[model samples]
Target: MTNDAPLVPRRVLLRTAAVLGAAVTTRLLTAGPAAAPGGPAPSAGPPSAAGPSAATPVRPDHRLRPLAGHAAAEGRRRLPTPVRTRPVLRMPGAGHPMVLTFDDGPDPRYTPPILDLLRRHHVRATFFVCGEMAEHQGGLLRRMVDEGHVIGNHSWSHPLLTRASTAVVRAELERTSEAVERAVGQHPQWMRAPYGAWNRRVFRLGAELGMDAFAWTVDSLDWTEPGTRTIIDRVLNGAGPGVIVLAHDAGGDRSQTVTALRTYLPRLLADGHRFTVPVRGEV
Candidate 1:
């Protein structure tokens, strides 16, 4: 069973508050203008799921905007220089892409069905699996990769990294990466902070681990168990060029997410939003 704790209503409000404080005001972390959402899918073929294992350090991709223009002085610990202070709200210049991301997952109850739905639609999405959750669902993680979905680190226990000690933060991220590597033979290249809470240290440590941070432009709010129609409306209403939509496959009942995706994915695709996953080296 997935060990994730249910995100209560009170916690939801608190977390949302935290994210608004630290995020949403930041600039989009992009290289240049690419195609908008109404453009053709990339010629590179379907989204690639293969990435370096946790042991290998992956460089930050276009999703990150460094706090400064230059690298830090040498002799400092081997961290990714010019770490970001925020997460990528949208994928700029990537071409008419609608990125779908799920957090706190690999839950046996809900994740499989969502995967099935995505497969039926010939779509690929990102799954930010918590380490504790991923450790138990290695098969699901593997299935996600085999089926062309990107798996990213959502931390081990889904704690607020901004409030945890540096050691705790490192352990949370590193342990989760190791779990993912063990399950899928690849470490994540992307991560999303729990509750959207972030600090400079969180960004530096994530970069050190060879991962970039990604926030969302549209939140389905499925975790709240809001009606399926409500979730669909949020996603469809928020749909735009290069928007990253956030949903969840775990942490609680996700039937609404599944049902809502069944409705909205087709609508968005019909409307010319091509579903794709973010990859390193794309600007």
Candidate 2:
């Protein structure tokens, strides 16, 4: 101990470190534009439900599965599909369904509260998780499944996919898929590129990994640390059928996002908007 050292317990240091983890996660957000497709934020609009999609019945295993032996390579399968040039902007189905997607998370502190809210409301949403975070918090991933939430790949580390090398990009996507597989007994079928950036390589690699690309229709701008009311306004104003609302559970001060979810979710539900996950048939 140093002469000037003030006594502090190891347990206290650990607890303090844990409390500040959410702020630490914020650095990852600056890796790229929060919504990608960099430009002025678009005016909020209700998502329209009109697009060509295949009619595949929902998979029975869509719910959470028991954790088993994890073999990343065997767990992942190569899928061949028509090349996609862009991300799926909205869902194409009936019942006026709107999708809720949280990116860059599964944080120990923030994710649990968000998950609790979703559970209380009896709603199912999608989480686009990072591999780096997922590996450390596999239990959160398992809880997501157990609660009937969808897990999608958000890459290993948040990076601009278009700027990275082909090999680098592949690793980012594949590693996240594998980590998720190792956690939930199934790889994520839905994959979202960080910063909403997309390219030929991204689309090709995603399909090959048996994944589909999902982008948001409404940018909550929650990543900006916008006020709680602003986040709610964005979602409420943008409410429409088949629309995908983008928010984050990790990556800095998601308390606002969490609160906004509780506020807007029920209002949207009362307005006859159903929350659903994206299926690959559309891709």
Candidate 3:
């Protein structure tokens, strides 16, 4: 499909401030490198396929469960309604609930292997994909949806929203959401600011755009090109209930990120951690 293709049939209505109800100001969240653009945008590559681990039987559920219910029970509320004062840093649920998220990608080289490994292990993850990248990697986005993974808006260009005007921020978010919906036939319900720099504009704008803002509790530091073992160690070390792990798939050489997952994902599973995607009002 062309980038100029019309929007999906569904109309995304922007919620007015009154409709949004009482507003609250959240603390700004920041981490990792600032003003970093997503690494090389995904280039065209072969259609996605199950990778080397395809031969392995896919586990049903991978002994995991969705954390939305548990989180809801914990009374994690929705955004722009009662209005969140802060982005969610961790998921709440029983049984060592954890979320693994990838940012800035859909890179054909690294993402396919990551997907393959997740498929092989029957694990589901969240990919916060950039619009420039997702626009070209529609197939990857569709595959992510088809496989029951969550796709979130990582902005059109991975800009630091804190530094951008309201219009620029909206465009960054809206364009990315449009790109994703055009590709996968649904709007993203979640969004993350690049480098984790989030301000009131981000929180309010994301809610107006119908997304829950998210920040990570654990930074894998994978984007640093730290050795593969270090990535694995970071993830394993940070493993716990209600933790969101931040890692990357595209931006620079992500071979290390891919390699680390192969080592750590199963270890997480073995340790009785159920990998889950967070739901709105529940994350």
Candidate 4:
């Protein structure tokens, strides 16, 4: 079972609130010149299931925004038990396989290039997208589906779910799910709470919505604009069986993430490691 303790320290959460909110606002307000006027949202396409698995993966990090204190406590109290719940920290028995995931994305500038790199390497990854982002860049979502990447719901606007009411939480998840469904023809079956601040309510809601909770086993800390080598080393030094490496495509300048991926992705593959996304079914 995943630990019931808070994923982020109380002090850290308190300290970073203003900064995170600003970043989110700045990202939306200045993401890239209003999508070129009437560029058009893409039509729906078939969504990918990939395959089923008994184990699931998830991630959280100090670099993410804070979770409200009371909410954080409640969330920790509600975490699912180790054997049956999908995420606590790691995916048990899934082997030296690694899952690479990007959150808060579909940013046209960075995501497209990141997608190109993944395509070049023929690597499949999961993208945990925020609804606002997908709504703004549906084409990117469509391209993700078209290219055989897994899309998971990250929430409507990247709010801390534990702090919101049940209705708000549902709306956050459902709205995003609907947006992704519109883009890719099916709702996502997996979810990762923003900042990994999941509470019992989140788990229940996610299960009700047919999702298995997942958190990353490893965080690259790339959002901090850490050097490329640092990010690469964080992923490489920490990687092991059933590890999920957390990264972001849109939270900020992800050039370091892009470069780090270019350096470490192939290296991981060359070192006899395989990448996989958690599929919906049988878990």
Candidate 5:
């Protein structure tokens, strides 16, 4: 059993709304009527479980919708520009650097091997660990810190943000941060919203808690379990300086993720790309 507590703060609700607005705006600008509901002809590839498929009803989850008009308000409250700071959207400056981040993990079945492979390659990556998962696997959490890997908060139960109340989000983050601190003796400095979902509230609360909000630049989409080759292709094609690549160590059978890493890590290293973590005062 896990500790039951309210996770998110009041500010997070507003912040989450803002981030969602940006995402929805981008989608509307780029998407066509064919991509809209009941307006499209069939395209190639497997029927998408999350995509438009006539066989399945594709109702958007109302709970996941971003709060309206929150973006403008957040824009007014943006953080002050700092001197001598790294650009928020630029890549890191450490020789074709890229960040590899794993979410919802510390699984005994998968995490150990992932950690071992990282060790073998002399690389460091970030693990956004679920509190529930880490609480039960404290040793893994300890190992992550001991081995110089960065651990981040990935919420407790991994609920979709649109469905959770502000309080719920705060609880998810705080409890997970507490768990990481207890196990590793230091609090997390970073967090990634579940499902790439972000809003004003999520960003505000994370910043208030002294964490930098991180989103991926390249999504391996490993969660879909595309074959190992597909996963490798996505990462290699997307590789670049300062790119944050998202993958998962748990949340399902991750055999393909494990296999793909074995192929790409060595290749990336040989290609002169150095794996790194986000430095403090950099984000």
Candidate 6:
């Protein structure tokens, strides 16, 4: 015989059980420590200098149990691996030496103007290029090298963190390094993590790959498209000896950044602040 529909009370109970089961599963998956063989034990205290006291013992909580060998291993397998950071380049010499770095491109639109200003000022700056962009705009990259400007790897896609999984992080940096090498005919000696997100893996991987990690002390934040006058004001106000000013050449219209550079480069030069790069074995 065919079975009839379930009774109302029984149906409600089954639905509630299913919902509770799902909630429990989700909590367990996203919850505290991983499940183990036994409940969590009270942490042992350090030895007392005088002597041990007769204190009441606290019972372990089964729900807060520490993971066992197999379970802990499995839990670890699902967790993200810790990423080691690359060693950062320290500022060279006590004398006034500032570095100017442009990121996210080698855009023909803005880069040429910026390059022209640098050339006019007879100063060299660093260009951190994305692999894909650089591959497509090899001419700009070539000009940068030929003009004595330093080219640094900013990663292939300009990822926010260079501490992603080893493969992904390496690919991000290596692809750009290869692109820069192809265009400039030399491997980059420096790298800057996108968004300045650095970690141990970023440090170790960059160093292992023979690139020094560089972070900016003065961020122009030109990506926000601030007015040209405001951009110039920020740079002029923040200019100091050994300060690294961060700017963008691409990722959007960077007219303000380009214009600001034109205004400040000459002014900074007049102010006796020499724009320069860190030399090997200097800092």
Give the candidate number with the greatest TM-score. 2
Please report the TM-score between candidate 6 and the true structure.
Answer: 0.68
Cα deviation of 86 in candidate 4 (Å)? 6.1
* Candidate 3 structure quality by residue, lDDT tens digits, 1-283: 0111112210111112111111210111123232122222222223222211212223465322222222222222333433357888887655436789998777766788998998888887899988877776666676676665778888877666789999999999999988877666567778988878888888888888878888788999887787999999999999987789998877667899999999999898888776767655555
lDDT scores in order: 0.69, 0.69, 0.68, 0.66, 0.64, 0.62
Provide the lowest-lDDT 10-residue window in model 2. 1-10
Candidate 5 global CA lDDT score: 0.64
Better of 3 and 6 by lDDT: 3
Ranking by TM-score: 2, 1, 3, 4, 5, 6
RMSD of each: 14.1, 13.5, 15.1, 10.5, 20.8, 26.3
Model 5: per-residue Cα lDDT at residue 25: 36
> What are the clash counts of all predictions, listed in order?
4, 1, 2, 9, 22, 12
Report the Cα lDDT for candidate 4: 0.66
TM-scores for all candidates? 0.73, 0.74, 0.73, 0.71, 0.68, 0.68
Sequence-dependent TM-score of model 3: 0.73
Model 1 weakest 10-residue run by lDDT: 67-76
Model 3 ranges with Cα > 4 A deviation: 1-82, 94-96
Error of 5 at 7 (Å): 18
Q: Which stretches of candidate 5 lie over 4 Å from their true place?
A: 1-96
Q: Considering summed lDDT, which 10 consecutive residues are worst modelled in model 5?
A: 63-72
TM-score-wise, the better of 1 and 6 is: 1
Error of 2 at 124 (Å): 0.6
Ranked by lDDT from best down, the candidates are 1, 2, 3, 4, 5, 6
lDDT of 1 by residue, 105-153 (tens): 7776678889998877777788998887776666667667666677888
| Candidate 1 structure lDDT | 0.69
Q: What's the C-alpha lDDT at position 44 in model 2?
A: 23
